[model samples]
Target: MDLNVKITVLGAGAIGSLWAVALKQQQHDVQVWTRSSDSEYSVNYQDLNGNTHPLLFTANSVEHLSQSDLLLVTVKSFQVEVALAPIIKLIPNSCLIVIMHNGIGSHEAVKALFSNHCVFYATTSQAALKADAKLQHTGNGQTFIGSLFSANSSYNVLTEVFNQALSPCYWQDDIMEPLWKKLAINCAINPLTAIYQCTNGELANKNYQAQLIQVCNEVTLVMRAEGYRVKNDELYQQALTVINATADNYSSMNRDVFYQRPTEIDYITGYLIHRAKKFDIAVPVNTQLWQTIISMESSYHA
Candidate 1:
């Protein structure tokens, strides 16, 4: 059965804009919630063949938040708390909140509040690049949906919405595998890109290959510690696959650093460092990566 739902996407970055437009195209009532008022709520949808289509949508402030059947939290990993603080209160427990962003811990932050609203975690390779006033859809990637803790009544409706309207998506009984795997790749790619000031594929250069491998190895060990099936070599190769696939794109961290904004280093590399400490495992490489990124942030922000 097809279910009609009102969805509010709470973020106006590249990915948020992409999902907002994509879901709206599917005939769902989708509204966007950004931090402030922006008249430049436009996006260029570039199809696989390089065809571009302009999409404009309704954008509202946090104060204007009305009831929606679902809320898609698409802010940066670190911005989740502030972004949803006021808006979450406006949302009812009956509303389902789905978080789609890079890295981890956002869901846990919400779970810490002990809210009764259904919460789910999502990861997507869907690539969108933000320009002056409009975001460009650079790539079409699949969206992966997973439960934050347990699947709830909204799972079927959310799954059906994506499966029927949005891009290719799946519901996982245990999303930790794919989530961790994606995390492994992000830890290897995003921070390094920020430090090196290069595109994803630049890491493929022989000079940076060792650093990439070390990061991969450290992440794999942590993933294994958490009981996920992970092989360092296999993850290394998989990371390469992601790099080749999105070779020209700058990582979110790279953008954050370049723009002198706060990066999600704490959630990505910082989270990995915390996990390593739990197992009393030495992740000197991850530690150094985290410190390097943090130091760069301080110097740049200062």
Candidate 2:
């Protein structure tokens, strides 16, 4: 299929760079927007066979991004608003905005802010990190996408673009389920790993297994009370499976804590705690994890 779409990736972080490089390789017109006024963003592509190649692309400013046919947002949750504010006027109302973020509430937040455009939520297990201006693709995983409502013709174009450029796009009637499911996994593993300074494998030890279950339980309760059909047992099993599969991998939150960068705990566990209060559901475990991450941030600054 011939891809005539002009794609712009905001943030130019690990995931953003990964998508930009992948799309560019597929023969699409791809550009990346970065906060860094630097002339170029470096990206390294690594396949499943362990081969790597480095490439550099020019970084465009927000005002120049308005002409893109599609915009993939990969900014940290906290930076979303600030990063897009100056460029909001540049985004065409007809352009599709795909937010491939890791936490809950991003879709709603983006939808509220960009009411005129089509906002879609996407989730992927593809692991990546930035190093020396290049994005390192660490692990391979599939991506799921769906509209906030039912399927539209636009989604057909999106699925085609994703399948050709990124691959393994699962279309769903309701994307919220997978969004919250991924959020449950993040709430269970990210904070614990960040706080304990351990990899996913370390959670398998007896000392951390029970705490892991508790975190999953807290997220499950909040999700269920919020009208999502997530069970504690199922979420716990999913967390365990992820821990075993990515045993040596350090989560993004873990990397943030290690680098003294701000973590996305507020959008992950903290979002659960905030919603639990609205539903009169108790989420002490998640609340504690939220507090712990906040304390870590305080200490990092201190």
| Cα TM-score per model | 0.93, 0.94
Q: Which pairs in model 2 have colliding backbones?
A: none
lDDT of 1 at 104: 74
After superposition, the stretches of candidate 2 with alpha carbons farther than 4 Å from their true spots are: 61-64, 149-153
Query: What tens-digit string does per-residue lDDT give for candidate 2 at 43-158?
Result: 77776567887876767755447678898888988788777777888999878888888787665557678888877878888877777665677777888888884465446778
Q: Clash number for every model?
A: 0, 0
TM-score of 1: 0.93
Q: Name the regions of candidate 1 deviating beyond 4 angstroms.
A: 38-40, 61-64
Per-model root-mean-square deviation over C-alphas: 2.1, 1.9
Index of the highest-TM-score prediction: 2
Number of clashing residue pairs, candidate 1? 0
lDDT of 1 by residue, 1-302 (tens): 24767778898888888788778778887778877777336667765567777877667744335567788889988888888777666886767778887887676778975368677888888898877556677776777787768855447668778766556788876766677777888899998999889999898899999998998998888888998877649889999999999999999999988998888888888888888899998999888988988898899846
